[model samples]
Target: MQCISANAIFGYKKSAKDIHKLEIDDETAFIVEMIFDYALTGKNSIQIAKMLNEQQIKTPAWYKNKCDRRSYEVDSKTIWTSAKVMKIIRDQRYAGDMVGNVRATTKVAKNDNIRVDRKEWIIVENTHKGIVSKEIFRKVNEEIMPIKERSNVAVGESRRQGFCYCAYCGRLLQKENNPVNPYLFCVRQKYDVKNGCDEMKIMTIPLQATLSAMVVKYVSSLIELQTFVKRSKMKIFQNHKSAMTGDEIEKEILKLKQSTISLNQRYHEGRFTKEAYILQKDKIRIQIEELEDKKLQILNGIGDKEAQKEWEKELEEKIEKFKDRISFTESELAEVISRVDVYSQTEIRVKWRFMDFTAKATDYLVRAQKIAC
Candidate 1:
């Protein structure tokens, strides 16, 4: 027998007030209140389920089916199933976070539907609250979400997976929703109303692979760019330093100050009107202030020598540790690499941090080839 009352879920009890006060979305609050109500009434889930059935209250599935104009054929016996009750109590959707399908299609397919990979799930935070503590709900979800196998193959290729766009037009050209059969589609088809992508029809997987491979190769070219930047950064810094001459800046400052003094004298003698004098003085004052700030910065030094040295030491340590390692985890990869852009066919373009260039050029190339034909 439960000790809690149903109304305790609503109108706020001392124990649940802290959680209730939290600004959660309406959907989440509704779930939380429902759970609290069930707990407070001292009734087990079955008793509550029976009560709901007696009242002919709608279930989430029933409501959704009704909204879609679909027929409800399920037995009342299964409507109050403990699994369904537990699922509602534990759902994270009430916690104000949006969790959604990462790879599954809206259209039912010929073959068995497989679960989407966790990496594929598009999640956004601050969605809602739960019936229980967030920590408890998270633990329950961990038990529920599909665990990935080390060597598990994804059932279907994602629609926009590993895709990049044209910087000029933002048109994404690639094959999407590839399973046993795939289609190539232009991003402009979805976004633009007029004169969308003026391009070729959906090429087969093999052509996409080839194009993707070329794109990857194109991005790998940036390795040379990384090398070039590494070699030239010191030279660039030296050139910038040389351009700032203290004596020339000081001369300009003195000239501006002299002009300001002359302007003030003309105003005191009533040779200039008040508004004209003020406008001229304001412009000169701004320039003088800028020159002063530059002079101060030069005196204090333009760069952080200690911080720079610390970073250099940290880089050396990381390089030493990773020198013998064959590869990096995703986090390490993210630290060095920026974005990967995909182009039409099998092209993979990559951008890296200033120091070095590294690309998963081989994997993408192989995938594209496998996809072709």
Candidate 2:
């Protein structure tokens, strides 16, 4: 994994045989955390980027692309931009995982790197400790999802239209001059969605209404999910209650005890001197005593129910803070939603942020894609 990209939190180990683990860069990690936190406050990528640049913070790309690490040019060229901020949030690496072979190999040199469908790509999670929690990562990306541009959108077009897509084509919908399929519709041109999709259009007005309501509902449900997950994590840890498995320590104990038994049998058969036998028995018994002590230490650490509960509380509080920042502001309705798909004037598919969190929360309350037409 470290071999693929130089942008890893931690670079590859000196040992070639070692797994490429994420090494946290203390300097950049704080920067990343700040960016994610600011983003939750209804700031767009451009706004967040501007703030970071004004604070004289070095961009992540600055650490990567600059040939001379020492040069300090005080110009816009040496600062964070919207594109950089959006790229960091969109990356799966900040969530502490890397995906490989996501694009099919192509013959054309420039147009060759088309992304494969997500289902077809390989995903390996929890490979290393993430700088941001999975929930935080998901939350940030949920905010800044790109919307397609339109040529003839009305002045009063719904801000929610930025979150809409074409159900048939999976492209971000574009508002146009067409009266019949007015508002967000797909002109599938990107290879990712263009092929295998028939032309599709959705009426803009109703889609905006449906999505706005859904956004409010999902954010409300997140409050309960945060509370439930806190208790559940603690209960899970307490139930297991062991740092090392019982089988591991027991196996070691059994192995050492059998060595003493073998020594006794050998002594009876006159295979060694009494002096030799005594020394060997003493060594085996010492090992047994050490293992017993280690077993007790491990058990005591895991059995600290109070400690585990306290830790869970701290985690829950952090999650609450993160969740509190997530909201659908009137100015940035586009930030919270990824895309809505248009099926008809009365029906559309809304893909909200926090897929797993939102999916579970809105399971009975909302439909996924197919809604009333």
Candidate 3:
């Protein structure tokens, strides 16, 4: 088959004679063959991955990076994973087939490539020399794929589908649909015990209760902060207005205008020079402009207070809606909570989306109180 020069597939490299043609990479091909052999021996993908990791074999990603330094960059700690092993076992290229349109990207999500249905894939058989024989590939697929599919059947949608994660292994926890009580546990613990992940199983009901309480507490705090900020801003504005009365500002402007009149009369009477009269009149003009600007600012502060009242009302209404919520839907949870890390049945840490905002608000409140004092 033809290999793209941009990034050649694993276990194959571009031919020196023809840049478009692919040649078997002996080192990576042996690894691909070993994966198929393991599948033929009734070993599951997880088991095969564990065996490879124990042997400290470099993964396909590492091989790809070795062949072309720019293709894939992998750390020294990179090890074989079940997903990587399964991908090698299912690759048609190793069976001498040319497969196309196996995955496609859409206009709406250009970066997200989704697998096309098997029936829609364009696969041509016996296109090139194979690392594994066609018969062996067929047998491995027929024997191992069905069992994997059966084990992965979904029972129902989980309420905490994408939010729950294992605190130890940092893997997404899978939901188990137990009849009495549904729970979430780390799937890695089931497959690989030595993977440094503990057995994590937390019931969905108690988790939901914890999340609900956290959300209620968060909403109550936000409402209080909003009220405090509104009142504090109004109080600051009132104190500022009391410090400088509008009547006092008007009197200052009147005095400045009278001084300008006196300066002009002195210049006409030849008591002061033209330049001195002009400079003195300009100074008085500036003082009157400053007092006028102050009056305008005070008037605008009244308008700002009215607008603040409306904004506070709208914010309070939204916060109040969540303060009394007994439970959160999956979509609602996704909007406010970024993730929930489950350490155990009783210990979980929730990261809320508004944490940064809350911290900034608290800082502003402290500064505002300091200024008010």
Candidate 4:
């Protein structure tokens, strides 16, 4: 059984012998069941949290620390938040499933734990006795949760559904369709006005214009860069060909394959530890795969003028659509921009997608300039 931590999760007690063998804590299991029942009655996470707080129910963090002295200390005054309630409701473990690889730490951002996509999550069903039945959990999550989320906005009303956020509280800004002026405001401010930001609101017209202008600028810049590269006769794809010949790539791949065999031999001879062998093998595998892709690119004539022209034409069309107005679709906007932080109409920050392309383009241009010199 894979080691699991049930300390923070309510309604589950971890076994001393094997943490994976989780037992139901009857006391907290009742709360878990009640939360699901509340959801079934059309109560949202916020309402459920409010209800829990009203009842003076101890939070999972508080309960964990009280039960175990060694457990991480939480404030005695810790109260149930909507986020915490939603987390518990969404947890598959409460429905008798063991989930793994739900989150990962990247080498670039070691301290930050990012959620892995649900499709990538490894789940084993009937792992332990459930606090709530799987059917009830699924209905609450898939049916009830989505309905509660969309209960605020009318169908086809949210243009900037997932992208826009409140700069003050960092919560998603909800759209308000006022006859005089439609605007986005921090929804939290509506509930907790004292704690929430009053200044976190922006008119939709200006916000859309800002986003449209940003998209236009981004596409325009890319188009200009492509034109500059073409005019300079420093083909971006051609540079890759010049960097490494097809024969050279094949040779490198062969060397990597040979290294892999040598690594296996060392592992069998007990020279390389299992951890070191696996790590080195993975690195070699990645290098070989990259070399193979380069070889394929060269073979497929990716440096041809037709391919370059097609790529430029695509960018030109994208810019043309957003040139006149904010005609860019959600999918198109999502392709270029990851998020939009709306501080106000005058101060909107956009986190763009395809940042790697910009970095690569700059590197290519610098190398091209050096070669020209």
lDDT agreement with native, every candidate:
0.48, 0.58, 0.72, 0.71
> Tens digit of lDDT per residue, candidate 2, span 1-373?
5425433432212224444555666756888888888877767666777677567787654664453433554333345655556666666777878677666756756654555655686777877667789998776665344442111222222322456655554545667756765565554422123243334655655555666677666665666665665565456456545444646877999999998999999999999899999999999999888777666654444444475456446545534544544343534556556666676556766665445543432331222111110
Between which residue pairs do clashes occur in model 2?
A: 10-23
Model 4 scores a C-alpha lDDT of 0.71
lDDT value, residue 14 of candidate 1: 23
RMSD of each: 18.2, 23.1, 8.0, 15.7
TM-score of 4: 0.45
Residue-pair clashes per candidate = 32, 1, 0, 0
Q: Compute each candidate's TM-score over C-alphas.
A: 0.29, 0.34, 0.67, 0.45
Which lDDT tens digits does candidate 1 get at residues 210-303? Answer: 4444334433444444445445545445545554456777999999999888888989999999999989999998998877766655443333
State candidate 3's TM-score.
0.67
Q: State the TM-score for model 2.
A: 0.34
Candidate 4 wrongly placed segments (more than 4 Å): 1-10, 13-23, 26-161, 176-182, 190-198, 234-326
Q: What is the lDDT of residue 174 in candidate 2?
A: 62
> By descending lDDT, how would the candidates be arranged?
3, 4, 2, 1
Error of 2 at 67 (Å): 7.3
Q: 201-248 in candidate 4: lDDT tens per residue? A: 888776676677778778777767767766655454444435776788
Model 3, range 1-373, lDDT digits (tens) per residue?
3555475578877778977777788877888888888888888878888888777788776766666655545763356666677677777778888888876776664676666766798888876788999899888877666566424423222123578888877777777879899988887664557754556899987888778878888888787888777687767656554455667888889988888888888899999988888888888888898788767655544434575456556666658667767688766776678999888898989988766655654554454444334
